[model samples]
Target: MERARFDNLPLEWIRAFEAAARTGSFTAAAQETGVTQSAISQRIDKLEKQLGTHLFLRQARSIALTVEGETWLPHVQTAFESLRQSSEGLFGAARSRLTISASSSIIDLWILPRLARLTEDIGAQLSLRTMVLAAGAAQEDDTIRIRYGAGDWPVAYKVPLYNEMIAPVAAPELLASASDWKELPRIALSGPRPGWNEWSARHGTPTTPLPALRFDTFVSALAAARAGHGVLLASLPLCAGDLAGGKLLRVCEESLSCHQSYWLLASNEAVSRRQWNRLETILKDPVPREGA
Candidate 1:
């Protein structure tokens, strides 16, 4: 009955193994770690050798955890999460910074504009981190996350930022063309959320296929629309500034409510009343009028 030695375990090897297990792919784990796939495989191999167990059942197209790996995964994840929380508590207090995670489009279009007001009100420096929703990024407990989806995330307090509404928008110049605007090339966003098909259904527009220009993010799609490349289906709150500034023009009066909405999600540890109040005030404030 010899006691197990903890000193021999390498943190990096465990990290590599955990990432690979969580993502179910060595390639994905490598991408997350900013390492080569071969390096990830090597690290996992080393970890398995050290532990004397086969952690993964490798297949041609996928990888599955062996029973040992499945049991080990939670412990590894919990360890990492604890480390993150401890580091944030130690370092974040010194900097007096609050970190927030949101999609690039949301940050660029909505949050960035109002950030100064938030900082001014909260008396703390704010750090913005882009959470690429398209990439399946996990939310960290150390930060507040502005995520778009149905409000059902467990272990986090969810606050409705806004009810999602989408409408067609284009540069004013697009209206000059003799062609019907509906027939104009449409910009499409490809992601978890619905796009033109859903918009059409909601607005009673015919579902006939139109010439499309696809972009992976709403930011890019909106940029293309502003450049007069095509009409874009834009989230109302995200585009409020553009519309107000006349950078973009609503193509029609019709707006469609989406099943999904932007939510402010914070883990229990992160959701202090003061911090919540700061965010609530920032979002609840009415957009300033022109020249006001």
Candidate 2:
């Protein structure tokens, strides 16, 4: 038996056939794909004629895939699904010039202040978007995503950005007046990272609830700490400015080494773009030695 050439098969016809096969009814497939049942039937008919094999057997109100169609259904379904995902993803990326998705805290405390230097030095147009950590999230269209995680990204090449450190911090006045560590107010910030609990555990101090003020991002938590509300569990580099300016003070002599590091993850297709390259440079820059 002669086999039909794969290139000769119209994509539309294959899609219609797959839909009809999956749904077991042309009317249902038409409803799913938003095309007339007649159009669906016509395409399948054309495909059958092209392949010189009957793809479906008609019944009273529904149809069943012939042996040939049954054998072809899985491959066609997989191909169409891959095509759909690629088209949607690439098209979305092409619409945006440059978008960077990062943790809200990093954007607020670290990246936002340093944005001007990058813009001036790199001399490129760019935009930043922020998001909280959630599993399997698309940060933005064709955007470079700076993620804080252990260095294993299932997709995309992961570049090590930097390791993070956390310590208990508060306003200078609050620390100066504070007599006992137990009496001090502890501010919980952002997600459950290396915070007061970790600090308490390390020093074998009893975990006491200190009139907690909770925040979803480090920026707000740092602001609250600066306002003299309470001591905050802050990322050292992120809170470096406030710490230097005397807006925030380190309450704990000990710090936690967060094994989780920051990473730069970009879509495979978007890696060669100029905007992505500039962002990569800033991410990989050497850490400055305490106000150097």
TM-score of each: 0.62, 0.60
Q: Choose the strongest candidate by TM-score.
A: 1
Can you give the lDDT of residue 188 in candidate 1? 83
Output the number of the lDDT-best candidate.
Answer: 1
Cα displacement (Å) at residue 20, model 2: 32
**Which portions of model 1 show Cα errors greater than 4 Å?**
1-95, 133-138, 286-292
lDDT of 1 by residue, 114-151 (tens): 77777677666788888754566565887888877888
Ten residues in sequence with the least summed lDDT for candidate 1? 283-292
Instruction: List clashing residue pairs in candidate 2.
Output: none
